[model samples]
Target: MASLWSKISATLPLNEEQFPLQFSNKVESSVVERLRQSRQQLYSNTTSTSRMLNAQIILDISWEKLNTGTWRDVDKEWRRVYSYGCLFKAAALCRENPSEDELLQAVRTCDMGLLMGAAIMDNILQDIVRILQCEVRKSVKEEDEGEHMQVKRRKTASPHVPSIKDGLAVPRIKCPSLESFNTNYLLPLKPVILEGIIDHWPALNTHPWSIDYLRSVAGCRTVPVEVGSRYTDEDWSQTLLTVNEFIDRYILNKSQISPDGVNDVGYLAQHQLFDQIPELKEDIRIPDYCSLGEGDEDDITVNAWFGPTGTVSPLHQDPQQNFLAQVVGSKYIRLYSPEDTDKLYPHQSQLLHNTSQVEVENPDTEHFPEFIKAPYLECVLQPGDVLFIPVKHWHYVRSLEVSFSVSFWWS
Candidate 1:
C-alpha cells in the first residue's frame, strides 16, 4: 500500500526484447521539447514551480485514448526520449528537491511514465494538475519547511474542505499532526474505492453477455493472444489485426451474425452485449462509444475471454483506471502498489507496464530485481466482483477457469 524508496529501478538497461514501440515521430516531438524546457527551468526555480505545474502537466502535453488493439502503434513516441535506457534521470532530480514544476516537467519528458503514473496519482489526488494550477506553491525555506506545515494547522486562514454532491472524491485527507501517521503513508497516494456504488451490478453477473463471445473464441474466429505483455512470447501485430477484423465483422461487419466467443475481447465486448441486459441501458454506451471509446483521463474497455486459462495479453498500467468485473469464470489478481514504481522497471514514455509477467507464485527476482521487495495487494475476483485498480499499480492475472469480464473507466 505504501513505500519509501531508496533505490530507483531506472538504473538498469531496458530489455529491448520486451516490446517494440513504433512511436509517431510527428506527434511526439513537440512533447519532448516542452519537457526539455520545463527541466531547464526547474533548477532555476522560475516563477515558482508549483504555480506553473498545471500548464506543464495538462496543457503542454498531448494524450491519446486508444483501444487495447491499436495501442502499440504509438510506441515510437516512447522510444525517442528514452531510447538509450530506462532513462529515469529525472527521478533523481525530483528526490533531491521535489517541486511541483519539476515533477510535472519530468513527467513531460517521460510522457509514458507520466501517463502511467498519472493514472495512479489521479485516483488519490483527483484533478491534481488542476489543483496545482489553482494553488500557489511558495517554497518553504530549509528551516521553515516543517514550520509551514505547522502554520497550516494552527492558522485560522487555513483552507476548508468542500463536500461533493454526486462525484468521485479524491483521497486528499487533512490530518491535525504528522505524528498521527506513519511516514510511509505520506509517500504514496491512496485510492478510496467506492463500495456498493452501482445498483445494477448484481443483475449483470447472473445474466452475462459471455455465452456468445466465449463460444466465438472457442471456434477460433480469432486466435488466443497475449497483447503487449512482458510475459510469454507474443505476436503483437497478428493479435492486433485479428482483433480489428473481429470488431469490424461483428459490430461493423454488415453481416448480422450471432456474437459468439466474444468474451475474449475483454470489457469492450459489452459493446456487443448491449441487448442482453436492457436494464444496463443507462450504465453504458455501445457502438457509438466504440467509435469515440473511453476518454483519455480514464481509458476503459470491456475485454472478453474464454480459454481454459484466461490469460492477459500483457502486464501494464496503461493510461487508465481499470474497473474489472468477472462475468463467468473466476480470476486471481496479484498487484503491486503505485509506490513500487521503481521495482516494476516500467518503460519510460512507452505504452506498456514497467513490469514483466513472471508468475509471482514463485517470482524470479534475479530477473526482476525490484520485484523481490515490492509490496502488493492481491484480490480474487469472482463473477460480479468489481475490482478497481488505481493507475500505475503493477498487476498480473491468471484465469482460474474460463473467464470473462466487463471493465470500463471514466477518470
Candidate 2:
C-alpha cells in the first residue's frame, strides 16, 4: 500500500502522505446500521424490498467528498450539497451475488471508490443468476429427452466479434432502463457517456461544461482530496495542473507557475506554470471545482477521459483493465491491442509507464513500419459514448470539443 501510494504520488505530483480526511462517527454508524438492518431483512424475508432500498441508499452516499481545507463554511456547505444530491454508491449495490462473508469483507476492504468490493458483490450475484439459468437449461434438456426418448445433436453458428451497434443499439421504444440494457453493452473497459441519464441527477443541471473549463476547473481550488477514499493523490490537488504540466511537472519541481487559478478554485498552490491560461488569473466563477480524475489502476488503470482543446494525459497504462466514459464533448480515441507489441515499439528505457513508445499522432513508420497494419479501433466519443480499451491496449485521446467523462477500473 505504501509503495502504491508513493508510486501514485511520484507519478502525479501531490502531497500524498498528509492527505486530509475526517470521517464522522455519526455518519459512519448510521450507514453501517442501515446496511445491517437491510442485510437482516434480506436473510429473513425473500419478499422484503429492504435489500434493494438499502442498496440504493448505499449507492447514493458512497462518493461524498470529505471536507477539504480548514474552512468550516466550505466543509458545511459542501457536505450539505453532497447530502442533497446523494452519492450513488455504484459499487456497493450493483447486485447481491457474493456470500455474506465475502460481501462483508468487500465492504470492509474496499477503497473509497468501493470499486473492487462492489464488483465482487455484483460478480457473486451474476454467478447465482448464471447458476439458476443453467439449472433451467438442464431441466429443459431433460424434458426434451423424456419427450423424444432419443438423443440428438444440432449445429450452431460460431460467434464472431460483436459490433458496437450490436452491443448498444437501443430498440425503438419509450426510453432506456438499466434492466433493459443487454449485458453485452455493459462495457468492461471503456469510456462511457451517459447523456440522457443526467436527468437522474437531482441537484445538478445538465447544461454542458466547456472543455477549457473542465480541465482548468481544478486550478480554481486547491482542495486535497482524501487519499484512498474518494480521490487519489493527484485527485487531491486536482485543480493545480494542466493537461500539459500534469505528467511533466511530476518528473521534477520547477519555478514555473502552477496551473492557472490555483489560488481560488480549490487549489493550494500558485506558481509560474499557471500563468499560461489568462482566464484563471482573471475573474471567473468556479462553476466547477475540479477536472475529471483517473480511476484506480488495480482494477482498470491505463485509462483516460478526453477534454476539448486543452485536456490530454500522457500515453500510459497500468497492469489492469480500463474503461472510458464521455458524458460531454467528443474525443477521438486511437487504440492498439496487446498483440501489436512489436509495432508499438515500447520504450527500452525506464521512468515512464507507457507501453507504446511510438508517437501516437505521427508514427515513424521508417523505424517501425508495422504500425500501419496494426489492428486498431477508432471512435469519436460523444455524450453517451463509451470506449473500452482492454488491458494493454495502447491508446491516445484527443478531445474534439468540450468534453466531460468518467473512467472506471479495478485492481
Using all chains and alpha carbons, the TM-scores for the candidates as numbered come to: 0.38, 0.36
Q: What is the TM-score (0 to 1) of candidate 1?
A: 0.38
Count clashes in each candidate, considering only residues at least 3 apart in sequence or on different chains: 35, 50
Worst 10 residues of 2 by lDDT: 283-292
Instruction: Give the Cα lDDT of each candidate.
Output: 0.39, 0.37
Question: Tens digits of per-residue lDDT for model 2 on 212-311?
Answer: 2332332221112211111112343344233323322321122122232111112112222122222232322111101112432232222223322323
RMSD of 1: 24.3
Rate residue 196 of model 1 by lDDT: 35
Model 1 lDDT tens row, 87-165: 2233333444445555444323333332222222112122222222222123213433453344334211111112332
Where does candidate 1 have its weakest 10-residue lDDT segment? Answer: 1-10
**Candidate 2 off by > 4 Å:** 1-219, 223-315
